[model samples]
Target: MAQAAAHTDTQQHPIRLYLVVWGWLFILSACSYLVDYFGLAGYPRWSLILLFMMLKAGLIVAVFMHMAWERLALTYAILVPPLVLMVFVGIMVLEANYTLFSRLAFFVAGS
Candidate 1:
């Protein structure tokens, strides 16, 4: 049987990947913040603020956190709770919209 090769001394490590991922994450974060800061200008696409925030958060979680490297069960274990909470939040926000707008309308009319 062929023997395995003897282990060599410490191998050279590459810092490029780590630097690139971190740099990309920083850029994404800065861009998202810029969008939010400028959203105060009364632009029509203010919802893009939330979209960019979500995208930046997703990239940070996936890349910096290595969320894509886990098993399916582990991924579900980590992700399902947030998924459930977001669903609940969405439902609550939808429900609250009517109440909020109705109250605002009444307040405006009264004033």
Candidate 2:
């Protein structure tokens, strides 16, 4: 049917966009590795690493997954889970510092 053909065309547009996005993602990853291997970054090493990772993730989500076109509720569903895990990571880091410092203080007091 003509409607089915039109529907197929609409689907193809996003697929094409996704393919292009993936191509750029591959290029970015390759370039990031080259930069890292060449030791071109003058600042903190993790800064470049995290920047590339975030950029790659953003492109993957925005173009490949089409999260940029999604509704707010759907976007929140995708984004919130990782944010919860990040909060848990932060809490764990704080707890680790607290425990380590407490043990050190106890050792000092006992001595």
Candidate 3:
């Protein structure tokens, strides 16, 4: 009897929340597909696709994976590392571009 009571006390999320998240996921997926369907190319297309993908992934993690209800420390633990890695990647890309441009400039000027 006590175990049944404890089980009942556990968190129960509403179906509506899951349904709403599913809807948003579908919409985001459609938008991602549309980026390709409309024949978009270059940075704008890639940016929009990446943005939608991130949004959908966030929604799945937060809602479906129940991360949204988790404690702040756990959320940070799960999310922070990937974000930091992305930052490092962006920094490396910048450095690489600078190196490439400098090399090109040096060679062109020398010639």
The best candidate by lDDT is 3
Error of 2 at 13 (Å): 2.5
Model 1 Cα lDDT, one tens digit per residue, 11-63:
44358856876787778778767876766544544566676667777776776
The digit string of per-residue lDDT tens for model 2 on 13-70 reads 5577768888888887986797778877567566777788889999988876888888
- What CA RMSD would you report for each candidate? 6.1, 3.4, 1.7
Question: For model 2, where is the 10-residue window of minimal lDDT?
Answer: 9-18
Judge candidate 2 at residue 32 and give its lDDT. Answer: 76
Ranking by TM-score: 3, 2, 1
Best-fitting candidate, scored by TM-score: 3
Q: Is candidate 1 or candidate 2 better by lDDT?
A: 2
Candidate 3, residue 41: CA error in Å? Answer: 0.9
- Could you tell me the TM-score of candidate 3? 0.89
Is 1 or 3 the stronger prediction by TM-score? 3
* Count of steric clashes across candidates, in order: 0, 0, 0
lDDT of each: 0.74, 0.84, 0.96
Per-residue lDDT value at 32 in model 1: 64
Provide the lDDT at 84 for model 3.
100
